[model samples]
Target: MCRGLDSLPITCLERAKELRALFGSFLQKSDHNLKKSEKLKLSDVKELLQWKESFDHLLSSQNGLCLFRAFLVSEFSEENIAFYLACEDYRATKASKLAPKAEKIYKEFIDSDAPREVNLDYATKAVTKENMEQPSQSCFDEAQAKIYILMEKDCYPRFLKSSMYLELTRKTRTG
Candidate 1:
């Protein structure tokens, strides 16, 4: 697929939409393969990340956000896990119909005190200059920051300490 907007064919973009409609359930079935479209929403990011943990560390992998944010961000700079902030810029955002649900999950994640933190780096950065001022770090700290910091580190101690190579699972059945 042509990654560049200039060289991208109209059909390819359209096909992506078609595929989302076609295999959406299957894609949604696996947290690793996010169901994204012309735009990536905060709700989508949070939901995808939640699924990632359930899918046995699949979503927690390298530049996983980059896989999506890579397209949304300029030039797809090899960083995938930078997305999933769970909250986008509040100022210019059109107010996602899904924001309430996403917000609820964000609150729950914070309240539950999940072991890892998700990052707001990508979602907040997606805000266009014309859109809004940056959200406070507190908003991110509550939403998704700490875990993202670790996800960015890429090489965690657990993966290093484990002498056994447990086969990773990609699909989420517990859901």
Candidate 2:
């Protein structure tokens, strides 16, 4: 899991701010005709526009997933996506490795003191803890669903409205 900006050293934070400003400026200038190398293909524009159709569409596209994860990081809610992705990966784990994998996920996301703890309700956490007693592919299903819904309803809307997203879509449309 990535550390929050507040945890970064002052120099690192300054550099991050600089990068953000540079990126913002670049986006602002995107309306100007770009060199061919810098232009997004029509297909890319279509693909990016698809992300706005639904949260599932965003998650299904690799570029959309990266952009969404970055948006979540900016909002300091990246752990939600991290936990959701972890559960997706866990579901494919071999049965022989389920116990250890499940325990790792529980400790990292479900435990109260976990560094990247997700915002699960008490009941969901309890159910997940109980599920850990006999680790299986479905053990994290409930918690994952809760986090997914939370992101879809909350973060996804904000992301759609974010300057980064708006600028990209706007640029793509007119470029």
Candidate 3:
């Protein structure tokens, strides 16, 4: 909790936009029609708490998640909210959605010296200055699709947690 805009930097804003898109895409992909009033407190769920903690941990820098909290946490992106729900859809419904793409990417990058363990990590953080310079809708779509393909086989509990998150997304939007 760092509140207020004074602590946020311009570059962090840009990254927050990326994270917003990512979270939004996940919310957009949800198959169920949910409302913002739905209660989905994640504080009590150990696994989800871990994931959220890890996600929050990723943004330790100055105002790392301010925009995400303001934009994504408050309300859905309105336009692409549907797309964000897709993340859970394919994950819950499709069995092998995320595996193929991840396998392909891992194979592609396995021989080469990639810094991260998986392709999503490499893909999530677009490294080039050109990528960092401007936001690309295509990149977000591609990332969303690839992740969907990779996570389609997650367990039922995981999918349920994701679904709860979708409900949370809608709550965040209207509340």
Best by TM-score: 2
The residue-by-residue lDDT of candidate 1 on 1-175, one tens digit each, is: 1234433345544543443343334434445554565225333334434533432343443323323332322333212222234443332345343344434434433323422223334444333211223323233332234454454354232332222111111212332
| 1 against 3, candidate with superior TM-score | 1
TM-score of each: 0.25, 0.80, 0.21
- Each model's lDDT: 0.35, 0.80, 0.37
In model 3, where do residues sit more than 4 Å from their true spots? Answer: 1-7, 30-175
Candidate 3's residue-wise lDDT over 3-87, tens digit each? Answer: 2333335575566565445444544544355444322422212222343444433123223234333343233221121233333
Clashes per candidate, residues 3 or more apart or on different chains: 9, 0, 24
Clash-forming residue pairs, model 2: none
As for model 3, its CA RMSD to the true structure in angstroms is 16.3
lDDT of candidate 2 over 87-108, digit per residue (tens):
9999999999999999899888
Pitting candidate 1 against candidate 3, the one with the higher lDDT is 3
**Ordered list by lDDT, greatest first:** 2, 3, 1
Query: How far does residue 147 in candidate 2 sit from its true spot (Å)?
Result: 0.2
